[model samples]
Target: MTPRATTLADVDRGALREEAERALRALVGREDAVLREDQWVAVEALVADRRRALVVQRTGWGKSAVYFVATALLRAGAGGGEPSGPTVIVSPLLALMRNQVAAAARAGIRAETINSANVTEWDAVHERVAAGEVDVLLVSPERLNNPSFRDTVLPRLAADAGLVVIDEAHCISDWGHDFRPDYRRIRTLLADLPAGIPVLATTATANARVTGDVAEQLAVRGAPVDGTDGATASALEDVLVLRGPLDRESLHLTVARLPDTSAQLAWLAHNLPRIDGSGIVYCLTVAAAQQVTEHLRASGLDVRAYTGQTDPTEREAAEADLLANRVKALVATSALGMGFDKGDLAFVVHLGAPASPIAYYQQVGRAGRATDHAEVVLLPGREDRAIWDYFASMAFPPAQEVRATLAALEAHGTLSTAALETHVSLRRNRLELMLKVLDVDGAVRRVTGGWQSTGEPWEYDAERYERVAAARAAEQESMVEYVRGETCRMAFLRRALDDPELTGPDGAAWRCGRCDVCGGASAGVAPDEAEVEAARERLAVPGVEVEPRKMWPSGMAALGVELSGRIAPGVQASSGRAVARLDGIGWGGLLRDLFAAPGGGGADLGPDGDPGPRDEGLPVPLRRPVVEVLDAWHPEPAPAGVVLVESATRPTLVRHLAEGVARHLGVPVVGVVRPVDGVPPGRHDVNSAQRLAGVARRLELDLSPAAAAGLPGRAVLLVDDRTDSGWTLTVAARLLREAGAEAVHPFVLAVG
Candidate 1:
């Protein structure tokens, strides 16, 4: 490595560019490495004028290059004396940060990161930063609101920081495809910075609206406290916005519509091997990703799975395996998206459609970054819209829920998230998200223990949320149009993102001589009929192990329920089976369709058009699979009779399913148990403690005359339409045991 550049204020402009080129060469370890014109423009803004810059460029366009180069210049400007305070990068994922730290090292810039994975070393990392031994310090967005970090460390870091970089800046904008509430805290971070500390924000997936939103946010010097308006700040006028065309010339885009999950898996098993190099196969859910991974490996191909639920160490190993080309592809969800750097990734295939074009573009951008040629394929499933709707339902909570959360915080003064769950109905994840939003809006504050209200009156922005919801709907529709192939796929995406380079100076539409629509669709090497049959059989093979709840959810006692800690082995339901998971790539599609709410958003509405799991009989096709799963299942102590758990909405379906299971087992229907009168019906979406509380309230065994005759000292099968949180099964099994049943075995058609 060459010696570091010294601070030189009198250097000529041309020489400054040359110095940047030298730093880039050292960074990339290539003598020919040079900064692109746009990259240089961003660096100059940060280094020369101390101005904010948002560089919206393609993946391979060296967005990281701009920041590292700027950091080098800013540090060198301090000369042999104390270097400027470290450049603090607010990154989204540890995977991204790790890759960036490696890249920074190549440039001789010492980069250190503090993320959830490396909590033990955070104090050391903080000490290094304080000593100016770190050039760039990467921290996750969540770190900004961490009480200790925010109150103690952040103020100092903000005051002493040379430059601040927000990687994945699109997340800051509500209009962006993947918005996070934690990212909103960046405005507070920026507002706290000392004057003249240049901030740089970078992203590859922002459309025109997101770009404006992010750029305005980067210019937070004189912006409003809430930023809930169109009022222009004087600082916004000065921020530099560097946007380039998003076209990936090396990518050959294709969208193939498949009839069902079986065909989609078959196509992947067939085409993945023929796609040349290692790449990615994205699924809409964790279950789907795991299934695809299993299918690909069973087809004698190298594959692995990456999802949000994967362990941290295993995720790192999987990433390394992919980067080293040890695996042909990683079947993954959006957890693999955003800032995962694999330069030579040859292809990106989506097993299902993403809800937004920009989000899809971001995922596909993973491929063809450094390669001269790469494949980008999307096999849109028939169930894409339903899956999209399922995810869309997880958006911001209702006004009443948000207000209730704030009220709870106000009433309690300060409550840990667990304690707060008792005061409000929202699940932990959704509740934390609401608290972050409240923190960002000045309605609450995060402290050492948990969260507290600021006693500030805040009105729900129903109109803004409605507008965002409308925008999301429009994005989904545009994605559908893209799948229909009404226009060139590349052109459609470019236009959707409002790419300024969609047209030339002559005002003609830009056309890429690639993609299924632009270049005529090809009959690519197809999977054999045998492969399709195998995939179908795999989908048909049912039985997802339904592990009974081993322990009660914490805080049940706080709700006046006595349950807590480990469930008694005597009362615990034996490990059982479900025909399939509601998120699986196999029977999941059928389950989703069967259990869909009236509006097609979730598995909530019954056939009577009411909320909760649908009240429908096990369909003829699903019945066979359920029976097969039971026939194949061998419980330790055989169930003596069926004890049907009466469903709030699906009583008929539960009875019908129970009868079929009983016929298969050669057992009698001995009992039927119902919830106590006026008890709240099954609530599937609540946190575990709340769900357990509801289960305790609702469960009361009223055995029939036949049960009275046969129930004593006999094992019974607990039947239901589905299991969510498995609380109902747990509590019901306890009741059955208490009613003189020797052992309880839980059976369900699906795990939703």
Candidate 2:
């Protein structure tokens, strides 16, 4: 590495340490604020020695202080001649960037961020960085890959950068929980960086494997980081690993094994107040987060819902409320993880366990950062594994699909994601994810329009993908083992994360003496009977508004379907209703069980050679709820008949539901909207465009005189087993309305 900053030997020791202490006082605004030994060591290494370092300390350990202080001294040319360029930091979340920006200002450092949320400020921010008015510039991982930024701004920044920082560095390692494909671009950035530019990588949750992986990734200085000829690179050329113990003395950890989702809800409602401060209640899915938020609010607790699906504005508002202690808690999913800091948060409760231990540690690390005492509780449910599997299904696609995607991009120089859908049947998210992975793999490149192949040979690494999958499965098992073990809770976590200091020089294992196993905590008591009953009542209430699809998916005609644009008001179905969400707290469990599809579960034809088998109508547990739904719903003109959306996979259930609803309405069972003979039965879980094209091609009303005569002329309730993307219900309703029915209203068992 080229040397641009001051050398360690030439600087006077006394003056340099005093200047560092002076900067620390200004950064923290404390008269007696002095840097800890390790913090001082890191600063000296970066500013004086000019070397790359990786610090893996627990939360609230002054890691951010190390970098900010370094930035201040380096910008002032502390006992040196030339001032360094702005320090570019690659942060993972907008919340983290906000916190960093504010913290930087407290230290008298001029900081600005460029992200999707602040697009209007990009030019101004860039100008400030160029004019040396800004000391620190923060950018998200995604912003690094933008064609404009990569081609224009990045080259200049790399040529003159004085320091680089990667926050939440654990995300850059695939072995770590919460691996992001975009973070892989950091390797390229490091390769392009000019020599003598000191770098720093920090995280609070990386294990031994993840730490090594991140160190290796950060060593790419225009060549392979891992030396294979005979010798490996030294610390001066790569990274200096500074790892400390991973334990929180303030956290009072406990595991409460609840019987079901309702019981877990009851426990939160009963105990949140007793914990005595504002905090967070975490759920596994968006549906659960919404359900818990609604139930808690109704129980007279002030709270809000925060999830991935929540609006960006609302997320900001919720974060502000939580920080200000305006609400008791924010019932949220993992979307609220990492860099959301509150000094005195009283507790962190999980309604469902995360898939891995590192993830759990990262989340709970948010709380008790500035406080000496806080509660950390886990309420594990049987449905946790199912939720994990659901998320795990979003991994890299098969080799065939990857090759097909590459071929399509090669054939067409530039294609938008929507136009690319014309060639591949994958959903938007999965397709976008695959494209990103391929981009990093050197087989494709994103451009002005969309994406283009790089004309590079690409081979799918199936074995490596398998290894990653296996590692994930093992982490899940470790999470399960954690809840069931009787050993030291803190030690178990440390070992899982491979904390180096866990087994100290004394050859003894470390224990927190504060967790449930250490007999320093207590939280196993059940909730009150009254609270449980109230939660049950709330769960038992059935109804979720299923909004109909307003516009058609783009590029449907490319897939041999003619539908496009908005559906006319005359043919569109009115709003609809469902019993509950498949991942909800009340009827959610029952519906999941009712619709569990195992090996052709109701998919094939019955033994009698009939298109749809005859079976018992509506399960016993669901009959009264269906009646309750009808009683609560007052559709216009009432229903003249019930028309079944032919479910080739669940025809028996669909037929039974149609017959039951028709009987209750005192009307006839209208003719079924059968699938066309040649089309394949499509899945309900794919993306909007793909699902829409499939439904349009598979479903239609018979035009034969005999079949047309059975159609209903007035309003009808269009019935189906479930609604996923809502495309099935929308397309089927349009077909029925155009055939003969005057109006359509959709009803379904569940909305997933």
TM per prediction: 0.73, 0.74
- lDDT, candidate 2, residue 348? 95
Write model 1 residue lDDT over 89-145, tens digit each, in one string.
Answer: 999986898899999998899999887655546778888888878999999998988
List ranges where model 1 is wrong by over 4 Å: 1-11, 78-82, 222-232, 503-507, 520-523, 544-752
lDDT, candidate 2, equals 0.80
* Prediction 2 TM-score vs. true: 0.74
Residue pairs with backbone atoms closer than 3 Å in model 2 (clashes): none
lDDT of each residue in 250-289, candidate 2, tens digit only:
9989999978878898999888988777999999888778
What's the lDDT for residue 468 in model 2?
A: 88
RMSD of each: 10.7, 10.6
Shift in Å, residue 540, candidate 1: 1.8
